[model samples]
Target: MSTPTASRQDPSPATDAWLVIPLYNEAQVIGSVIGAARGTFPHIVAVDDGSRDDSARQAERAGAIVVRHPVNRGQGAALQTGIDYVLDRTNADYIVTFDADGQHSPDDARAMVSAAREEGLGFVLGSRFLEGPSPVGPAKRFILGLAAKVSSRSSGMRMTDAHNGLRVLRRDAAERINLQQDRMAHASEIIRQLAATGLPWREHPVTITYTDYSRAKGQSLWNSINILVDLLFS
Candidate 1:
């Protein structure tokens, strides 16, 4: 993947962590998401994945540093671009992988970063099922649960949610991550690579707000099944 140049600079003070958001065609909610997150996390990098909407402009207006991909890339590629941007351009100690949609919570992200710092953990994965049942539909819940079990067996790292878009990785663990699966399969690929790092990691309970818009944009059952197959064969 080519390095994307930042569209603008973030005026916030240098912090210990940076939120890396993989932005696509989420112009409707990306601005508010970044605005709310900026209250807790000042340093945010939104990698725009060739969005045809106004996502890049909205993110820039919300005070986030925007990195634009010249063409449409998969989420994994967008995430890797954001990660590389943080590592190469900033001095942050932690990198948080946050969703561009308004599903993930800024509070959860802040808490995960706090846990990583307080517990000396290198990786913190967000799990929607850790604390209790999530608001997802029954079919989606079953699919995700099965995927998590399969991922645990294959990667040797037990996880309650395999494809959750919220995660915190310290600089060292972030450096070890090289996502080759440039699509939905990268969710499981991330677990496999992170497990190989032998870093201290744990799952954190996170709330996923499935609003009407996010629900409409959620992955389909067929795609979920494909991710399972990827986990099994990759």
Candidate 2:
């Protein structure tokens, strides 16, 4: 539970904002990914969810405060760990959940933070299905569109993109959330939790770049079904 380390990247004047990157077995590109994130954020907490590779080492080398899990946990657990680290160890006014897989962009994160401050929103969700056509292919577009509809129907909110990983939570909202689901299903669980906790939320448009690596690591339709099952059982 040491204080999260600072990187050589230019620190934002608002020291209370912390970016938490939850990843497992992403060593191949975690360094470069963290380096890119450093361009916008200074304080970073990279949670290594028991990756067998050198993810923690590379994250450290790239100047991220590394938190290691003794065993592999789901993304939900990793995010909860990072958020807990921020809550317990730092006076983090804001916490942004950014992916280590390079699918997410730092610019969108900066915009979310700005929106949180200017609009005084407790939660800011990044939506890919907002204005224009998505950059993704037809299959992905259909799946994501369905996911958004399912999430909106389940949570009773006008959700544009349901399972998007990029999100910003104000400190109070961050503390109130309790993520019990440890896998990809946690995405839906998040929306449910927000609804239950009565946290004020807003959404901003964002893009999910489909790189070769991200494409390879993308979830299948079966995975989506499993997420639905988890949400139903919970």
Candidate 3:
């Protein structure tokens, strides 16, 4: 990984939380996403996973700390690098894993962090299926539901949505995470590792807005199957 580059604006002192975004080639919308998220949570670190486009520059211009990987590492490696950077460099008390795509709501992220702080919880995972039916299509919903059940059974933690990217981890809980799965399978690996930490955790109801852009860039059905396979084997 290259040395992290920061924008001119400093992190706001309004909140003690930092959002860790795994960035790929979302140059078209990354600036807007970062701008919107910074309104609520000022500190953001966008780990650029070797994007060929101008994503890193856009994020940096939008007031995010840009940490570029020399090559195309997967999302898991990007996330781990962002987490490690936050732990090693910042005094942030909470770390939030947010997607570079615009599917996740900044409001939901704020709520999760609030819930974690209010309840003295170390981990708060976003669950699309928590309050009611998720907005996902039927086939995708079914697959994700099945994946959640399998993850819950294997990890010994009942989760409604195991693959949601939005999550809040207190410093103590973040310290316990060491992701070896440097790919999409890290979603399940995260649950297993967090459960092993035995930290108090809960699922927060969250809304995932599946925009046309996000749908186009979202994980494919084949990739979902690969995640299941990885969960079972890894």
Top candidate when judged by TM-score against the true structure: 3
Which window of ten consecutive residues has the lowest lDDT sum in model 2? 1-10
Candidate that would win on lDDT: 3
What digit string (tens of lDDT, one per residue) describes model 3 on residues 37-107?
99888999999999999999999999999999999989999999999999999999999999998988888
lDDT (10s digit) by residue, model 1, range 7-45: 222334327999999998999999999999998899999
Better of 1 and 3 by TM-score: 3
CA lDDT, candidate 3, residue 215: 72
Clashing residue pairs for model 2: none
Query: What is candidate 2's lDDT per residue for 167-195, written digit by digit as tens?
Result: 99999889887888888878888887776
Q: lDDT of all the models against the reference? A: 0.86, 0.81, 0.87
For each candidate in turn, the TM-score is: 0.91, 0.89, 0.92
Q: Please give the lDDT score at residue 149 for candidate 1.
A: 93
Residue 129, model 2: lDDT of: 78
**Segments of candidate 3 deviating more than 4 angstroms:** 1-14
Pairwise lDDT winner, candidates 1 and 2:
1
Window of ten residues with lowest summed lDDT in model 3: 1-10
Error of 2 at 178 (Å): 1.0
